[model samples]
Target: MQSQSVPRRWLSLLAVPLFLAACGTPESPPPEDAVVRVVTPYTVRSLDPIKQGLWSPEWGYGELLMRATDDGRVEPWLLESLEPESPTSWQLRLRPNIRFANGNPLTAAGLAAVVDRHLAENARVGESLPGADVQVLDDRTLRLTTARPVANLPHLLADEQGISVFDAAATEPSGDIYTGPFRVRSLSAEELVLERNPNYWGGEVRLDEARIRFVPDPQARVLAVRSGEADIALYPPTEALAQFTNGSGPSVAVAAQPLQHLRAIPNLRKAPMNDLAARQAFALGVDYRQLAEDVLGVPYRAPDGLFPDVVDYALPTQRTDAAEAARVLDAAGWAPGPDGIRQRDGVRLAVTVLTYGSQPDTRTVAVAIQSQLRPLGMEVTIASVDDNYAAMRDPAGWDVGLSFDGTLGYTYDPIGPLRSFLTSGAQRNFGGVADPELDTLVAEMEATPDEAARRPLLERAQQIIAANRYVVIVAQRSSPAIVAETFAGYLPSSVLHHISAQT
Candidate 1:
């Protein structure tokens, strides 16, 4: 299940000219009631909820039926209550008085329409909710039906990428189509302007507007905050934390344990990596401690497994031994060549590591991997692409890929990452992992309702992933942000988009 290539126009957003323009402008002093300026590495190329990815919810321009707490517990947000009526059925009651940005009331029919649109537009939705059907019980209540008993239905609905409630009547992408804290005032490749939704159902929004600017370069984001050109700079370089913590300028707020974990995925479908010993060598060759402490800086640590420590079912910390890695390569007949790189059957133990610019730290981590693996007689080539997913779909383009994998924050459970990346024929499985055991475990976990009952299955699934060395878990990152003094008390969340100013 390969992902489609990103539109050329969308990739054009990362052009050198646009990056220069973003860094060229100097922000003017804002009035007492001015828009809050936010500089981040992400950009929203499309206003369509289906194509927006996480930007719609992150910008507060759209809302989901359910939301997750800071600790990753799923709770009703747009819905007043969600209870399982049966194994395959659930009753959803929307919160009363909820309205879109255009002031139109949110009814069960409207919600149904949004669901239907998603099912029609996205194949993943239909695959996720097989034999899906929705019935509008009344103005506020709806009954969701599925062919299979989805134990984590609530978590699925809570996923912003899965289903977002928007005004189906609206013909185009605009603020009116969404029911969130903010409305899309204006959007471009470089910037997005969101105005507060006056008819917000939850409570009064303190800020009048939010101006989000896209700065792909981590250093540029840091400079933007230091120069007072941005109110909040998201994902600033970890090495630059010293400047923010000096107490002379803006302050830095780091998440306790961010759900984002940097992973190095090897192309199991390609040469050298196709061998289990090669994959194991690659994993053991990496210095997880140095990557977490020296390279990633404070708050970041070597991951226990595929997930962060915050996840209850995460496996024990993976082992790292360069000597063992070398021994494994030697035992596998990969002898060191004249240039010190291992070679066997005339094929060098060379790998192309792919990373994207969106999460700037991925490139840094890739470079570190290149350096660490060199001493182990592995030739690591780094290819920093604009779009990693698209590039990764073609295994010939790269051997190993460095990127962030979100567990609780993105999917509210470890099941999502497992099913998406490790299961047979799963989407985003660029590493080409296909294990019957892992697939069976994931299916059982999905069928099992209680979290307590599912813990063992989750643990076993992680063990399988680790044993196979499907992905080299580098380190868990701490969500770092530099904030202006005016927004001094701003704290970054493990959930990337759950942001707010401390007024």
Candidate 2:
């Protein structure tokens, strides 16, 4: 199941924007001093950094103590320095005179409060830093201690979706306060308007205003950029990317690596998937190479392992064999029926795939998998839902789920994805896979800080996942954003928090 090249029809879809550009009159561009509008599929559900996770910092409303670069380096952002005092304790020093957008000074006490709030409110953060204690030594310095040794403490703080520094004085969730380059002017469900923070500790802010519009539809987001209504569009349809590359429309800004990947998690608690042979058959049936090369086109790579090549501990590519998949099913007592669908006893070899429209690629890949698995006598039914995460919670409803997994992108470490998705009782382990060996390996990786020493542990963890087929990785894709020709300094990042617009 490999494609030599993308199909002719996909290449034909590139003509859509060209046709629109020739016939329809483009809208007038905004004034030079007007707000720079950005259209995206994501919506801000809450103003609170604790509730919104990395979105607040990504939107320029807040800042973190440390930041991870595009090339896997963790450096001080809001902090002056971070040094480990002992295996279980570390000291943090914040830069002088950093203040929130609302003029409140950011202090060690405020950071401690933010940590406390995150530990209490955000389960993900609490899980990463369990029994963590933060003590303010002074206005600018603090000590963080954990019950167990956390070698990757800096990595945890640098996590895009991890702890964010906010104004502790403000008791309520308001967008007005945060130590960032921009302050919230107005916020609504549809859009968020931000103004330059004149008192920002970091150098002068460039953009006067930035407006982020939450447009759920991918085509609508593309239209917003095509019509000159928006200066930037995030996560547009991949087929329409050719229109931007010719310099007639928006320029395509791609991340260094394809950190985000499409993964299918099989429900381990449900029928068919609970059987290891069935899970292996499901993994073997899908044509991942064809999906990446033909359907997704350029910038998308075939499924390799849980993490991409950029990650040092990533595993080698896994091959798929439809014949082997059929043999595995036959050995498992699943026989092909009159309709060509496999069955064991009275139950048919059927699975309902769960996906969401927010990420159009999920639905596209799901449909492609449905067609590919038909030859293996596996019945794959795709169910497009409004909420992908909520829908996947019920293991009884869906046997397989298709969604974009960015765990490594958010944390910049293999431990992040392994611990969050593959480990036993992980926060995002919707598949209900409880492997004790994997759990122990992830714990060892967490405790071992040295990247060189953690290699073997990481390798074994990936092997367990591949052998068990706990999650079927589909494809890895670059984070693409369409930027207007007028804008000059918008850098696309694997971690969304690193993205910023400069005039």
Leading candidate by TM-score: 1
Candidate 1 lDDT over 61-102, as tens digits, reads 777788765676778889999988877888989998998888
lDDT of 2 by residue, 262-346 (tens): 8888999989889898889988888888999988776688866777777777787467899999999999999999999999989
Candidate 1 residue-wise lDDT at 125: 78
Please identify model 2 stretches exceeding 4 Å from their true place: 1-35, 45-47, 102-104, 121-123, 170-176, 188-190, 239-246, 326-339, 342-348, 407-409, 498-503
TM-score of every candidate: 0.84, 0.83
RMSD of 2: 11.1
Worst 10 residues of 1 by lDDT: 1-10
Using alpha carbons, what is the TM-score of model 2? 0.83
Model 1: lDDT to the true structure: 0.78
Model 1 regions lying over 4 Å from their true place: 1-35, 45-47, 169-173, 185-191, 214-220, 238-242, 326-348, 356-360, 383-386, 407-409, 498-503
